[model samples]
Target: MTVLHQLRRALLKPPSFTQAYGGTRTLTSPYHTENNSTAFIKPDDQNNRKTQGKWLTLPPFNTTINGASLGKNIAGIRQSTGEGNESTTTAIKWVMRCCPQLPRSLVQKLFRLRQVRRKPLESSNSVGDVHASECQVKRVSAKDSMRFGDTVYLPITVEASPTEKTECLCTEEELKFLHDLELYKDSAIIVINKPTGMPVQGGIGIKRSLDELAGTYMRYELSEAPRLVHRLDRDSSGILVLGRTQYSATVLHSIFREKTIGASNIDLKSEKRFLQRKYWALVIGSPRRPQGLISVPLGKVVMDDGRSERITVVENVSTTASQHAITEYRVLDSSFHGLTWLELSPLTGRKHQLRVHCAEVLGTPIVGDYKYGWQAHKKWNRIQIASSNLEHKIEVCNKSSLPFGLNLESGSIADKQPNLHLHCKKMVLPDVSSAIKQACISSSDYDFADIKSLKFDAPLPPHMQRSWDILSS
Candidate 1:
């Protein structure tokens, strides 16, 4: 009998495999073909089969065998195509979706073992030999991109059910909330008005960080999760950008890094990719000058406890530990009641750069920034200037006469210790999606002007709005 017939007979009488193995070895497990059931070979049988070094050339499947489904078969050959929403998915991710119970390592092992296969991209139905090596058992990589309509073949099915699930940590309500936060979206990027108190990335005790939430729910329809391009403080609310694809993420990361390092050399109008971030902060006191730039080199200094760190203006700029930090500030509106609204634009990105410059360099501390401005807050309480009527010579605070932090109508105390008033109000950057495609065709010939710069503005958060209302009045 042929090898195919011998294998068929062996599968039919699994317990009596002595006829096939010449009574040297015995079959311990029957091949399962159910979708949920695992189709795998036992360890001894696998070793025996490997020693025999026999390759089974399966014909194009017409019907089920041993109740084996097309997609699920333990020992039976099968073909699966990349279908549904994914335009292009990695081989590893596709395998994980097909077999949820299979561990990532085992899926990778299947690829490494040449058990998984795919038809060559340039193959055709009218090609020469019927049993030609069109779908050879090669070492398929996990990162290999599987385009839509691509058929993947498997000679043997792997075990399932004993592996841990890889599911998103976010609940349905959290996902809905994140969906609402999306300010702008395209194939390449996603911009969100990040809420205060929600961290960009997870930490020691942070359960639901924005990055994790975005990666889970903010996929929209893309194959990969959106990745954070920049960072915003946990207590600050503002426009945060995310990249949907690997190429987009790399482009954005490089742009931000270049801007931070060589801010002075960059020409905004000429360089279309040049990124700009405008911030609006409410500070305790006004700057000495109405508008000017603060060029200070900042360094991280360890506090007395040795566990905590603080970013402070360093006297020596030449040190490797210190980075040159520059911020341009303009007093938008100032009130006699010890509050000033300042518009800030940072030329260089440094940790706590704006906060340190506002508090130390400008002698004005941002309102509600307790970490860097606690001393200023303790020195000044919210003084109610009762005399509403003011001369034009002095800046008149004109608006509703509502008191700060206390609602007289509701008799409820507002957020006493409000979040940081620093907000990333606006962002101007290149259209990354179009830019990427344009570069792919001919980068040298590509003109940056072909794509318009994207401008986004985020409104003030509730606490800041409330504070602004109280200050304006």
Candidate 2:
């Protein structure tokens, strides 16, 4: 029988194997063929199929109300839909809507309740933000519980979270790699070497990233768990930042938005439109020179008759253009030794900015970079660079020094070619709160160093890590 047929037969029988990696399905889970009962299959089983749909294409979101960039702070907001069933805050009911404009006061109030998380984004799901559309206000002054008139559709963002999650793929040995580089931090602005081949968020398998592994060392290391201020590609590795508090999230965001140029991360709060950024990459072939810049404006292109993601671009600005972007790059090193090593400084943060700039603009894409680059650039999907992670593996955990089952045997080697070598490099800013609070702003005042490292090697998947060792040697 065909594998599909055998699988289908098994699916029709009693206990099923098709459903295991498929994970559990929900009331909202779509049928294999969308609204068709004849084509029912779990996600994991669907993976083996021809993938009639797109690979890693983000699922459609209930985005009806993605609250992008707005902190929940408003006191009371009343959307102007004027419909009786409009969204409200107090209603337990939820209805899907797309990017609703919420009242300012209601937005502010959510920030107070801690109902929303400001940073260390829920990158698993591609869905961005959600705000309720309509909700009924209640006054339960003397009672423990309150009554409601009708279901108010308040703006709500629902991220994809697993009902049962697995331990992060970041293993004990991997943690050591990061620990050697100053990976752990109690204060904000923590750094670590991100491993490649894992999505930043939302999945069924044992994958890990800064967001997934943040909790592993969070409590023991800092007063607060750090949150990522930005995103890195699943395959790319390099420097990344985390925020410990909302205030830090705010300051760091401002710094990124304004692209502040000063060294003190807190000092650039007042600077307007100034950003300094640098990154490193190991590409497929030797570059023209060790250094140069690639400039282009990126534009979103649609594809598959609108079935899935299109090739994202960095198109130059047109005289009558609606969008424009520019990226600068310089090759730091190159070799017939196999590939090109480069340093990139992005002047802008457009979608797929760096990847597209590398593949299309400069013609030297980061090795293992998925979603962009040349059709044949299929090395591994892990970027040669590590995330802002800058620490080396610490020998903190010892198998011979451990108890029974936990004692482990290990083997490893370094990459012949560098992994995605991107690093946040450095950023500076000013302490804008007050002089009294400024004393805490010392650069050396960081807390957790578990993620910190002295060396930059990450534990790769067996095959890739092996390849790296062979190449580097």
Candidate 3:
């Protein structure tokens, strides 16, 4: 059978909920009715219906009358009784007594009968109960810069941008793109908004990355180029952080490595503080706008078969030796554009953490993800770069029949999907020592065309550029 068929068979297995576990062990979501009785009527489940559907719509937990919230819902029950117009003294009083935690904005939405209410915040990394520490406010001067020393904060943003303006970096002639730099300080960190279709780092068999752009920008500005502190998947787009000084790199690296707050960890305040990382990806299907926190434990799947790419997640191995992983997400927008714009925040660092969590646990696989429970490779070949294209080079002489069509002599084959889809859009942090802060850079924006000129695409062979252009566009 085909790889997609195999994947479907693997992922869509019917739940055997009743075969072994029976009545008392029925699986439940954050707000299951069986747990809370008042507002939730446990539909005549007397005889125990054995069969059920695989997918689930969000549960209802809020109640309202007329146009106001009677109260919040939890464990399948409304906190207060619903009454006329849900606005006057009675409704408000009930809510005040039983559901004081229901904020006014949320109460209004519920009263208006909006969809997709927030689920419980019981998970370790959920909005409530953050156990991380806080740091004091700090700043650094250009003189104390990492290029100078970690004694000061490094400024990353180099230009200003119109608030709420989403740059459409992908153009008709270009499928791959980069962001316009707003403020690029000589030290600290630099932020570049990457466009879809470009790799953040190389080695998809060999390709260009934002790494190559630093040198070009340095030449134009006659300043030092920044170094990449974190990474974004090639097919995705958005903002990225790069360090310009060794001290900045060392400091930022420590935060991420240790999972420290402001370094890359969540603390008591739920501030989402860190050398924080966030992203906006266009996912698949019509999903809940603000949904997703895959708390499944994850472990890497290594292969002894010598395949260069790892499988990321082992199949059907939940509740095993995997490390805990939390991926928070909210849908920004969606359509048959065959994509859903998403704001993703990863709580724990794991290899392929977000990608695997999105697919296996959350059930919303990224649009162009080829591995980790998607279809396996349909065709394969070595991606090519010239002797001059690569800073380091070696001959890729093919010794056997190629799986996909190939000249074997010439090196020019892109990976499946042509372009990967995963981007690093924004990052947040609270108490970073100004000594390592890259977020301190000023903010400025650049034109789409100007951002494109920073790469070495001019020397790309015509056929390769044409294909690159086609895939990117």
Candidate 4:
């Protein structure tokens, strides 16, 4: 054959050739016709065919291959695949089109190398440890700096030394008082009528609290002392529930967190149990409407002196620093003395929500509230003083602070006015059976078959009763 015709025939042949009768195959170079075993496909021709899917020739079996060049070729293929320019199907199709002698199964196996090498990098460390470290960083940075007037303040944390566990002490009279305070009790829970001037939980300089007394009171019936499921303000008397068992406590906590009682009737009638609490309060003046719902956000503002904090209606709703609080109030009775008796049902359990709502939103603070109440004793002097020369007065008082303004001390206002006139009158607990069933579904360890649903009503405390008697009379 002519040299030109042989060259053209080599160009027309496929890149990878197989013997037409399938034994051993020989690759002939386009430049040589001597049947040399050292002949190879030119680098330029191989690269151009790789890119353009054109036909070229493969090297003889004994031909020496450059390890570095082979690595570069594999890397180029991986890069193209990574960039989404080449997929497994496209690679297989290209391999078949350019090298018809290559098997489809072998091409599939070669494509799997990309996936094997591209596995996601995983760490040996636990995710919880990383999350806990992040939380520590956030906690360190969350120390709030509060400003009031000219002072910048930060809260101080006091660490107390561990004290010996001592049995609570109670006098016979006190024991009788505690027994009388029991509004309701069952296998799962105990409802107590907390009294005014009694702290629910001990605090700085406080030696005795209702919780201590409760421990002594229930020590006879329970091997493990009953645990208070929730807390009421120190001076705000009302119904309190104590869980007698761990399962009951967990269930009660979930109910309170979900605000089950305040949910709709459909929710109450569902499989889950619900609870409802009601309180009565006497505030100075009446709301413009006889009955209404107050929806406001509340946030605590530390005083400029850093000695105390006060709950107030958050004026700005855009910030996440404030919590949403809602309360429904009805004017039960209005007295000639400019006081109105109100029945309040809080929809959300925010600290001092009712107090802030009544004082700020309704323009009528509770009668004995010293912090958020009307400053009845502020003396206004009309002497025309220069605004620049007048110094702003700093007023400070120490009173028990409660969430949302519960039973805060009246301070100087207590001398003239009575104690906090708010009282938790009644509480409705969810059906014990339904709650236990739900708890069982959530946890296999729970079995509340012995517990029964309960409702309790607490008579108005002496201070509130006196005010009602005088105002109604």
Candidate 5:
């Protein structure tokens, strides 16, 4: 026989130990031809076509591995298939795309712990065949390439099973409370006037939050729950926005982030890509200028307790940690009793920016803002008490300026704690519902009538209105 014929015959010879084993064994070997293409062949007893493999070009080891036909492996786990082309995405990128809410740092930590795994590329079996047991437990690196059919296994910590968690985090009453607060709702977004003293998200010692309640009961007919697009402070009552869909949430988040970072470049009068938030604050004193901008840099300072932190105006303009804050203020009404109603428009979003600017920069701290305006409140109380005449004594004593039936007595009692007077009264931003619908449906046929900016107005909370009435009277 020729050398080539002899080599092929020898390669097809079965191993002597195969007879001792119960099941049939299959082996694939690559044969190179003159054209530099490689083909694989297997030895079989029944069919000649089954013995001859198809000619194919193998990709590099760094590329994604080929996937097997849809079949359960030895562990009864269904194997996924890959596309014909190679995938350029990394393992971590693929995981993040599958789970958008997961933090990147946590994914890196999982990779470091070797919790990310995948099925072996070579273990892919044909239709109705079972892969080796080891194939189901193979771990992969985060830097590894992800193929279309590759099954990337993340740890249980990454993807929690619904069966594992039996208890519901939100109660029925809380869900109803959230539903009652909804100001507007559509397919893309849900707007609510968040109540004062209620937290938007949970933290340490927080048993309940608005986000948990909304996600539990606000799903309606959608498969996924609503997600918060922006946050409102725990003590501030305002128009809070939540995205009903993932795409809308992502788009709204990007738009809000852009508005906060570059407020000067955004045109407030523009019909698109603009966010206008107007606040009504009951301040202790009136601004010297009727209406102007308060440009100041603010920074956070942790208290000596190491836990409590507060936002304050940074005296040094060169400080890198400080954030630039701009707010437009117009004096609405002033009272002879040392009170002023001010309309505030914050150009940039910052933590407690309005409270800090009003107290430190403009010297007119918001009423009931004890963190920044405690001293001003005490002075106003003393002045009002000293100048009290017998004629107006009964009126002042019967109707206190403080809300929630509380007086100016300072203590740990609930009656002494006052509510914040800074309220988010109005907002104007791009119509997220229309934008999402237009992107999903036919763009050419979409109507532009409802695409105009969405306008929302929230009335002041009872406490704020009472403070306004006291000031006006």
Candidate 6:
């Protein structure tokens, strides 16, 4: 036959175990068909044809191997390889490369298992043998077998533990109240319209709080009871978020701290914020400008009475334990009764930020805010008495020590005290539906369809509603 024809026949011939590695012994694999076998050719093996051992593929098995099952197989392989002096790390690497579906957990498990198995064996072995075994295991762990860079291919079937699930001890009435207060609910988060006088978290004298109520009442069929992601003042009524899972809490907390609202002129619009909180307040007066931004630094100050602490605008920005607080306000409506309905949006979440800004910066204090607005009200009353005619000063009584219009007879008291008029009216949160869906795709416990975008508005509380009604009338 011609040399060209012989070369052509050699090229066309199907690859056999003997043809590939000049051997009669065959390496069997389940992936192979009757006609063809997959060959793994190592660069070192190609050069050193005289090597004693041939690369062996995994034995054929009837059952399919998943991530956890593969972990067991890897443990066995690592244990066996550690016993022998031969370098099987290259073979394990080839197996991992070929079967990309194997999980990274398997690799870690293999190392851990090998170390554990080697410990007992090494205790009884000669010093030389223990040293050799340690060298081999360390070499495999350091360089060849454990390099699973970034991606991890875990099986869709994850084991769910019964211990992970939790139950709450709340009454039926509390559950109903929670249901009524709910603004939004999903697999990941629950947003509730918290009422004034209810603390977000428990304090020294606070017997009940939104957190306790949430733990009791918001236990929708989840592995654990929902947890609060952020806090609102005890007197501030508004939208509050609770994470249904630890993962959700972590994610939401990070998002709230990092994200921003409304796009800037720069490319910052592309990086959207996760949380947007808008508040409504009935202030005693209007701002000089109809709408404006307040960028002030605020710090905590202890009053002379030593019973309470309040946040005030810092004059000396250079030296103080102060944080930058920014708030945007717009006059929604104004009344002849010396009250203005203002929509306040805070860029930074400082304690009593909105109240301090209105009282100090804008020369307008929020109505029903005793801490900030009470002093302003007394001053205004004195000014009015001095300026007004005798007809206006006809009736004045100190029957109750409370502020002029804050008598119990007035229907403005929501709880025991005259409630703060500030309300968290609206909140905009990022849509985490896709993430929830992905997380729940393999989970039979949670229904993925229940997860959705978090955008909700809470109705004004009773006191604020009453004040609004009076102002509108």
Clash count list over all predictions: 1, 110, 34, 7, 2, 1
What is the model-wide C-alpha lDDT for candidate 4? Answer: 0.51
lDDT of 6 by residue, 78-125 (tens): 223223312223324433433323343443443333311111223324
lDDT of 3 by residue, 128-147 (tens): 12231002112211122111
The true-versus-predicted C-alpha distance at residue 22 of model 1, in Å, is 26
Which is the winner by lDDT between candidate 3 and candidate 6? 6
Error of 5 at 110 (Å): 8.6
Each model's lDDT: 0.60, 0.38, 0.38, 0.51, 0.60, 0.53
Model 5 lDDT, full chain set: 0.60
Tens-digit lDDT track for model 2 on 248-267? 55445644554422222323
Q: How are the candidates ranked when ordered by TM-score, highest leading?
A: 1, 5, 6, 4, 2, 3
Give the per-residue lDDT digits (tens) of candidate 1, residues 362-470: 9998887888899998887665433343222123232243221112121000244656888999999767766655534442333445466789999987667756666
Please identify which of the two predictions, 4 or 6, would achieve the higher lDDT against the true structure.
6
The C-alpha stretches of model 3 lying farther than 4 A from their native spots are 1-186, 202-208, 219-225, 260-269, 286-290, 303-305, 311-322, 334-339, 373-421, 429-473
lDDT of 5 by residue, 326-438 (tens): 88889988888677888898888888999998999889998778999999877765323222332332233333433322232221111244577888999987776665445
Model 4, runs deviating above 4 Å: 1-164, 260-273, 374-415, 437-453
Q: Compare candidates 1 and 4 on TM-score and give the better one.
A: 1
Report residue 162 deviation for candidate 1 (angstroms): 9.1
Which scores higher on lDDT, 2 or 6? 6
Ranking, lDDT, top scorer first: 1, 5, 6, 4, 3, 2
> Per-candidate RMSD vs. true structure?
14.7, 18.6, 27.8, 30.0, 16.2, 21.0
The most accurate candidate by lDDT is: 1
Q: Please write out the lDDT profile of model 4 over residues 8-114, one tens digit for every residue.
A: 44333432212211221222332131211121223454333223222222221121122122222221212221232211222233223223223344334334322
lDDT of 3 at 115: 18
Native RMSD of candidate 4 (Å): 30.0
